[model samples]
Target chain A: MYNKIGPIFKKEFSSYFNSSIAYVFIVLFIFIPNLMFFYFFGGIFKEEMATMRRFFQMMPYVFIIFIPGLTMGSWAKEKNEGTIEMLFTFPISQWKVIAGKFFAAWALVGIAVGSTLFIPILTQLTMGDFDWGQIFTQYVGAMLMAATYIAITFFMSSLTMELIDSFLLSSSILLLLTLCGYITSAYVMIFPDWLGWLKVILNEISLSTHFNNFSKGVIHTKDVVYYLGLAMLFFYFNMKSLESRKWS
Target chain B: MISVKNLVKSYGHGKPAVKGVTFTIGKGEIVGLLGPNGAGKSTIMKIITGFLNPSEGEVLVDGLNTIDNPIEIKSKIGYLPEKSPMYQDMIVYEYLKFISEIRGISNEKADDAIQSMIKLVALEKVASKRISELSNGYKKRVGLASAMIHDPEILILDEPTAGLDPNQIIMFRKILRKLSEKKTIILSTHVLSEIEAMCEKVIIINNGEKVADNSIQELMKTYDKEQFIDFVVEGESLLSIEDEISQIKGAWKIEFEKKEGKNQFRFKALISEGSDFEKNLKSNSNNWKLVSSEIKKANLEEIFLKLTSQGEDNV
Candidate 1:
């Protein structure tokens, strides 16, 4: 399994660099947030900031576009080119291919996320008194959040034949999943009394509600499990989609 | 080495693509799957390669069921899909290496296998180029190389020469002929001449049914009972010659074509069973110049249409 997954991961990982999109995605991911933090939220990064809190705080939301953009073609493009047939016919299992692509997309997203480490590194030098632990936890939270989005969209890529459709569907679903958490987390109850149970369930299931723990420098086992569990479940869905052709 | 038993597949709507088709292929035999477009040739090949499962039947490769032992069967068979879609972003060498790795070739042997495949497919010149940059013919060669990189005992190619030019098709056939010496090959094509050129056995499918499966020579003789009195004649107007040829008993015209602005005409007539049409044609009219005349058996093309068209008499 490792032998098969290892080569697929390597090929898939490099496939990102094979096109200009990886560079484009990395540039945009690093710039938009940092650009906004310094330009729009300048006050937050000033003396009020002991950690790079504002920058990492909004990453999960920003990933709604970038993550889907990278993964919309993971399976969709293969289907368009008819390469998926050859890929699936190999002596490997479907799970390994999905896992390989998962890690590849996850690793590419990691690089996009990792490239922004210069932000915290340079900011820590200038501030001279920064909570490195908070920054680390924030990075971890952002990555975990990105992993969930990648898995979900990777599965979305397999559901559709067109790249545009995959991107639209993935972003819409990610937007909904991420937004439900934000809406449910407010202190005042936003829904009617009868619908209060829905808000509770949405909060429990919302991605940001779970991500809120890590962004706040708290690495709870529950939040970690939530992100990891959601990622695996979606990965399984992607495998199921690949195997659907065989389903009578 | 491969057996398909009562294969049936449906896309979950309308009619089943393949219906109860059964055939077995021997080891090292080059079999051509002959069918028109949308005739379920690719569907059956997919089931045998383990890319898709049969809805009602089972495919066995060397006694191992495709559903139960897919990986083992897939490893034994090398498949090239229709139109040869590839990862255009990858270089030819990188693509082959990746396929070799997926084929479970060890790191130590992978390089040698890649080199040999490049040489075999004549892809050395464009080995470093991206697949998208290559022409259709070269891209097909790359697809063939990637399929055969592992050197499996069985090779399944779906319309391998679908888009190639005449020169490339000839070259591709040469490579396939070489491979057939040691491997069992099942290649599907609508072009009947390709089967005549490369395969010893032909399996013809029509409308989700196996119409005929036989040796090329057997298919020609068994299904093609219509005998043709093929002849070429030269005459002016030929109005007199036509009326005379039409008067002959036990003979009906099958095809006729007159060369443009010329006195030459080529025609074939299907003679009735055991009739003396050849002698009657000689006695009927001697006005036209008889450039050539011969009574011949129907070729593979005529036999294929007769079998696949289901007695519609496409001729």
Candidate 2:
């Protein structure tokens, strides 16, 4: 299993690095958030906050588009180019292949997220105050959020052979999850008291609702479980999609 | 070494792509998978490769079940899909190097493997070129190189020579033959000549089912009774000749076609075994002159059409 996944990871990583697409996305992932922070929120470094509130806050939206782009071609491109058939003939577990691809994409997102740490480090050097705990919490939160999104995108990609369809499907789901809380709150305001339970269910499904607490410098166990569980759920679904394609 | 048992794969609960494919490819055997379009050839190949799970049966590679120990089974096999699956941006050497590394070869071994495979496939001229820049035939060579770079025991190739020039196809076949000395090869192609020339064993598939699985020699023997003799005749009108030829004893079937302006008729006479049909044609000289008459052996093309088309009707 390790041997199989190791090659898969290497192939996927090289595929990302050799293509200009990865560099383009890396630039957008890092530059756009900081640029927006500088133009709207005043330079992040000037604020002296170890917790990257601006960066972490913008990631949910950034990843809404970026994660789908990164994962849209994962299984979809393999299927499209007929490589998936090649991959299956090898003596490797289906889950290992899925994990190999998932972690490789996650690692790229990890590197992209890690690059923005320079901004926080610059703030710590110039400004006197730095909350190490809060920064760590926010970084963990960002990683978890990215992991969940990557899993979702990978699952969506596995279900379709078309890159555009994978992208649209993943983005649409992300959009719905991103807006779930707001949509539910608006419904609750107009609905009866008994129907307020719908808001609780909607909030539970909203990724941002759980991520927001972690971004605020508190590492809640429930939030950690939520993120990890969501990631695993999507990963499992991705494997099943691949397995189902063989018979279907 | 691979064993597939009663494998069935259906697309969306419709007609099964592979209804019940069962075969065993022993170690060092080069098997040719022959079929026409939509014959579930690719699907069966996929199932054996562990890419697509079998809906109703099991596949075992080297005694390891594909479903239970896919990784171990995969490590023993290398596969090239019909379209030459590859990363277009990476250089040929770099791509092979990556595959070598992923297959868990050491740096030194990876280097040696890559070097040998590049030489084996004659990719040295364009080793540094990006895969996207290579020609279709070259890309196929690269795909074959990747499949062999790891030195796996089994190689599964789908349509390995689909889009190559005649010269390239010959070279590719030579390379495959060389590799088969050390590895088992399952080659799928619609072309019958590929099987007759390269394969020791043949499996004919149609509509996702195995119609015939036997040695090439055995398949020929099965149809030996239906032997055909082709005769090119000069100075003969085909219309007048048909009745005289049909009346001959032991002539089970007769088909004739005329050549323009030449007064020549090509006759295909089907005869039973032990019949002196050639002597009978020679004796009838005044009615029709036998320009040339020889027994034509059944080639893979005829065998494939006979098996698949007739096999489908039986099913």
Candidate 3:
């Protein structure tokens, strides 16, 4: 199984490194978030700074767009060119193929996330005081968020052969997850106590609520479970989508 | 060896793409799967390769069921699909190397196999070129090299020469023939001439069912024992001449077509055993002039059309 998966990882990684698309995505993911933080929230560098709160605040929005763009073509291109049929004819299992592609895309996002560490390092150099625990916690939160988004986008890519369709479907799902908190809060404010069950379910499904806890340097087991559960859910669906093509 | 029993595959609950298709290819035989377009040749190939599961029935390769032991079966087979599916962004050497590693080949052997396959397929000239830059023929050669890189015992090729020039077609056929010496080959093509040139046995499918499966010689024998003779004659209203020829003692069936101008007609007559066709044409008293006459042998094309087309007389 490792032998079968190793080649897929190497091929995908080489594709990401050789193409300019990876560079473009890395630049946008790192520079845009920092640029936004510096331009809008200049108080992050103030003498009475408490934590890297502003940086983590900007990650959800940054990842909402960046993750979809990075993963929109993970499996769509293979299906479009009929290479998936050739790959399936090999001795490798379907689960290994899916796991290999998912891990490769996650690793690419990990590189992009790693590049942003320079910003925090710069702040620690220029400023005497910085919250190390908060910064570490926020990095963990960003990794989890990106992993979940990558899984969702990879699943959407497997569901369609058209790249544009994959992009649209991924972005729409990300947008919904990002806005779930606001939608749930509004429902609680307008509805009466009789229909309060709707608000309870909405809050449980909201990813932002769990991300907020992690962003604030709080390592709750429930939050970890939430992100891991979502990731597994999407990955399972991705495998199922691939298997369904054989019968259809 | 490969064996398929009552293989049935359907798409979206509609009519079956391959219905009750059953055939077997021995370890050293090179069999050709001949069929027209949409005749379920690819579907059968897909099932045998373990790329698609059959809706009903079983496929056994080398004594292992395709569904129960797909990975083991897949490792024993190499396949080249109809479209020549390839990663266009990969260089020729890189793509073959990736396939080698994926198939669990060690580094030293992978290197040696890649070298041999590149030489075998004559891809040494453009080994470093990306697949997109190569011509269609070169891309197809790369696909073939990838399929053979692992040294599998069986090869399934679908329309392997679909997009090649006449010279490339000849070269491709030569490559397949050479490869068949060491591997069982199941070559599928709609071109009847290629089947005639390469395959010892031919299996034809029509409307998703096996219509005929036999050697080329056996298929020819099923039509009729009467031999057909084509002659060029100078005459009008050859119908009367055909009627007259049909009335002869040994002439079974006679037909004629006018060859435009010069008052020439192309005539064909089926003659029974011990009948001298040349002698009978010469002994005729009519004003018909016999230019030339020869025994016509039925090629695969005629047999293919006769088996596939509806409402056509058997002879």
Candidate 4:
């Protein structure tokens, strides 16, 4: 076993913690979702039977904002700082470098997402109405949704050497992917024929479309395939862009 | 052993950065790649390191083509890029350790490699400090140390001493000199003296082409063979010797200046049979003694300028 991915993985993972912004990410990521669950969407105590539905509802919005911040620096900073020169010259394959950075960012986001485990457990402890299966699916859905976001941002980061440009481009795309599921239905009712095909396409492409069922206490094979497939597609796109950078 | 043949690299549709530049470096030979800014020196190094693909032609490292077998070629090379861009947050010692691991050196050997690199580049004092905290010179040493940690047989270092102080440059050259016995080195620099001191072979490139390729001794002897001869003669004034100086057949661009008590005259020489400028001067200036004369051959700095400036005019 070459274990080529281990050193890059270890270094990339520790680098996230080395900076103070990682703390900022965790605090805001955990705090904002809980805050919205408690205060903005009607308090947990205000409902007849409270659950983490609102928390799950806001997870996509939070990820659309934070995951770009995590991945914006992955390829963009390396390209800008010219570390890509040294890294690309190494004997290792380019995809492994992308994988190492992806796993590091995804795992860090996982920790921030994992801390929300206390959310479901607290609901179970305080109330007798929560479903363990729903909570599990929601956690699994959140993690998978994050994989797609991370993959998309990694692709965007590889397209440019400037960090700000990568952040802006990925952020705009992530926002569209998440919000399209909610907006496409309304647009279809107004314009039936042209907007009809959009519904079919967005159903397969939308981050919210697949995630909608998971939040409603159900998991399907199509949704799992949708997330993993999208994630893999974008990662492949990233590898292609890196190939162009080197070979072209 | 490395061989580059007819390498052509172009960005988009623009002019090729390297245009049919070909050279071969033998085993254990330290070759300096000298060029002006944007002269395709870095492009050649990048191609050799397997970081960039040549649009046409090929580079062979130990008989393996670069495009076909980049991984095997890369494994034998240790590269220090132009900027020496280390991860800013990584500690000096940690960076070397990372390189060792990626290079597939085991833990025990990696520790030994790290310690030796620290001592080699004199990075022991700041080994634990963050890379961003180190100064430019120290960062360069760290880059050099990291590149050599794998103990690769071929080294491709780009501007390795760009930011080092005088003392550090000497120390850097000393390290390279010691390593030259075992490693094949190809480095690029604008500082011609660095090449004169370190490399026996120098390749001067200009405008994406090889302008001159020869050793120091061969270059001095063959390149720009015309020499300048200076003669100090006892003379009252230029009027007395003007007629005799003009009759010199084998030289031109003659100029005279009065210094102390004698007149010193210099001319470019391309000596021919039976038409000697010194003989002419001596035959006419028998009235005034020829005090002393010296012939000055062109140095590396002059030859570099002559080669590259000529390149500047053509394209």
Candidate 5:
């Protein structure tokens, strides 16, 4: 299985380098939020503490767009180009192909997230008070969050034939997952005590709500399981979408 | 090497794309699947290649069931789908190299296989060029090379020459003929001449069902028992030819199909059972001139048209 999957993984991974899209995505992913955090009014770097709180705070929103852009064409492009049938008929199983493509995309995301390391490194050098443990957990949470987003986008990509449709659908779902908790929390504060239970449920379901635990250096078992569980759910759905495509 | 038993396939809950089609292709046989568009030719090929599962029945490749051992079956077969599925971003060499590796060719052997395939498909000139930069014919050659790179025992090609120039078609046919020596090849096309040029046995499908499956000579001989005569008479119309022609002893059926000219009528009818109505027609003509008389044996093209059209009329 590794013999077959290795080539698929290598091919898909290198395909990102064949064009400027991957580079452009990595550059944008690293710079855009940093630009917002360092240069925007009321930025985080203005403080002397060098905490990554504000950077981690903005990640959920940044990943809503970043992960979808990276994964929108994972399967949609294959279907659009009519290569999916060729890939499916190969000696390898569908799960292997799906896993290979997923890992390839995630590796690019890992690189993008890894590129931001200079930010924390520079913070430690200049301020000498960077929270090492919090920063490590934050990066872990970011990678997991990226995985969850990639899984959802990959699933969405398998469901549609158009790249734009996959991009829109996956980004929309990511947006809801990240922002709905905050929206419901604010509404719960405004409403009476009777609807406080609704807020609890929404917060429980919200991805950002659990992601915030890791961002704060709290390695809660439930939060880790929640993100990983959601990722697997979406991954399974992606496989199902591909399997159903044969009938379609 | 491939056997499909009562294969039936449907998309979702829609009408069956392939319905109760059964045929077996032996090793080293170059079989042509001739069909009209939407005739389930691609569906059958996909099922045999283990890309798509049949709704009912089963397909076996070299005695292994497609569903039970898809990877095993797939490993033994090289499939070229209807659309030449290619990665436009990758160079021709890179694409074939990827296929070779995925097919489990070792690193050392993969290079040799890729080199031979590139040479075999005449892709050496454009080896380094991206597939997007190549023309349609070259892309098809790339697809063909990818399919053959694995060097499997079976090859299932779905309309492999759908979009090739005359020269490219000739080159592809030569390649297929060379590859058929040890490989079981099932080629699908609507072009009767392609079947005639490449295939030893032909399987004709119409509207998702098998219409005819036999060797080319046997198919021709089966329908060759009856002959068609194109007889035209000038100077008067044979308005009552159906009535008068039937009395010519062995005349099977007569119908004046078209008006050839102002005073001429052309009739096409089957002459079966040792019918010799031509002499009777000439002897009975009052004023009309027997301008031309010709016998027409049903060729493969006519048979394909007849079977497919018959399929449509039934629907």
Candidate 6:
């Protein structure tokens, strides 16, 4: 099993570097976020807050779009090019291929996230006192959130043969999930006397609500489980999509 | 080396793509799977290669069932799909090396295997070029090289010569003939001459049913019983030739086509077993100008047409 997964992972991971798009994506992901943190209209300098709280707050929304673009061609390209037939006929299980692809995409996200270490270092250079613990917890949360988004994109990629469709589907799904938390928050403020328990359920399903826990420097066990569980759910669905081709 | 037993495959609610079709191919045999469009030739090859599952029944490669031991079965088979799909961005050598690694060739041997495959498939000229940069024939050679990189026991090629020039097709046939010396090959082609050139045995399927399966010679001999003689004659009225030929016993049918001159004609006579048409034609040489004559041997195309037409008539 290691023999099979190793080669698949190696090939998949290297394929990202074979094309110029991956480098362009990584550059944009790092460049845009850092540029926004430093020089947006009424940006970090105007906020007067030395912490990266605003950076963490807006990242989940940024990831909703970025992750889909990063993963749109994962399975969709393979299906469109008809290489999925070649992949399935190889001497490896379907799940291994999915796992290998997941790790390759996740590793790219890891590199993108890792490149943002400069932001924290710059924050430390300017501000004498910064909370390292909070930043560490926030990075952990951001990586977990990215995993969930990548998994959703992987699942979406498997559902169709076109890259644009996969991108649209995943972007819409992430948008709807993000909107759930905002809608439920507004609902609670307007009708406090009615259906208080419903707000709790909405927050339970909303990714932003869970990510908010990590940004606040409170590492809740339930929030950790929620992010991991969502990632697993999409991973399971992606495997199912790969397996369904035999019947389809 | 391969066995397909009562294979029945259907796409959702549609009719079965392959309906209870069964055949066994032995080692070192180049067998051609002949069929019209949508005749389940690709479907059967996919099932045998473990790319698609059969709705009912099973395929076995070297006694391992495809349903149960798919990866094991896949490891022994090399398949070039109908489209010859590939990663267009990858260089020819890199793509072959990738496939070699997937087949679990060790680091030391992978390079050797890939190099030999490039040489065998005649891909050295474009080895460093990206797959998208090559023409259709070169891309097909790359696909074939990748399929055989692992040195699989069985090679299943679906329309290996779909799009190629005449010279390329001839070169492909030569490669297939050489490959078949050591490997069992199952090829599907619409070009009947390709089958006649490369295949010793054939399994013809139509409408998801096995219409004919036998040695090429045996199938031709069985389905092509009538002997046809083409003769050129002058001073024979083309209109009265059929009447004159029908008068001879065992002369089943005759057709006449006008030649260049006014009185010259070309006649094809279908004769039965008891007909001594050669002697009779010479004896009646005075009646017409017997310019040149030769017996027409039945080919695979005629047998395929006869079997498929008979199948249509029955249906």
Supply DockQ values for each candidate.
Answer: 0.65, 0.49, 0.63, 0.59, 0.71, 0.59
**Local error of candidate 6 at residue A63 (angstroms):** 1.1
| Tens-digit lDDT string for candidate 2 (B80-133) | 988888878888988888778667788878899999998999999999999999
lDDT of each: 0.86, 0.82, 0.83, 0.84, 0.85, 0.84
Candidate 4 residue-wise lDDT, B90-160, digit = tens: 98888888889889899978999999999988998999999999998899989988888889999999988
Pick by TM-score: 1 or 3, better one: 1
Ranked candidates, highest DockQ first: 5, 1, 3, 6, 4, 2
Among these predictions, the greatest lDDT belongs to 1
Candidate 1 lDDT tens digits, A1-248: 78999988999889989999899999998889988878887735574676676777687789989999999999999988888888888999989888888889889888888898887778777766778888789889988888899999999999988999999999999989988888876644568789888888888888888887787788999999999999989988988888896764
Chain A accuracy as TM-score for every candidate: 0.95, 0.93, 0.93, 0.94, 0.95, 0.93
Q: After superposition, how far is residue B154 of candidate 1 from its true place, in Å?
A: 0.3
Q: What is the two-chain DockQ of model 5? A: 0.71
- lDDT tens digits, residue span B102-158, model 6: 899998999999999888889889999989999999999998998999999999999
Q: Which pairs of residues collide in model 4?
A: none
lDDT of 2: 0.82
Poorly placed runs, candidate 1 (over 4 Å): A186-189, B228-296
Per-residue C-alpha lDDT of model 5 across residues A1-248, encoded as one tens digit per residue = 78877888899999999988799999998889889888883565476567887788788889888888888899999999999888988989888898899889889989998998998898788777778899999989988888888889999999888989999999999898888777885665565689778777888888788887887877888888888999999899988988887666
Q: Residue B10 CA error for candidate 4 (Å)? A: 0.8
Instruction: Measure candidate 3: CA RMSD.
Output: 5.5
Compute fnat per model.
0.81, 0.81, 0.78, 0.72, 0.88, 0.77
Pairwise lDDT winner, candidates 5 and 6: 5
Query: Model 2, B63: alpha-carbon shift in Å?
Result: 3.8
Question: Looking at candidate 6, what is the lDDT of residue A45?
Answer: 69
| Better candidate number, 1 or 6, judged by TM-score | 1
Clashing residue pairs for model 3: none
Query: Which candidate leads in DockQ?
Result: 5
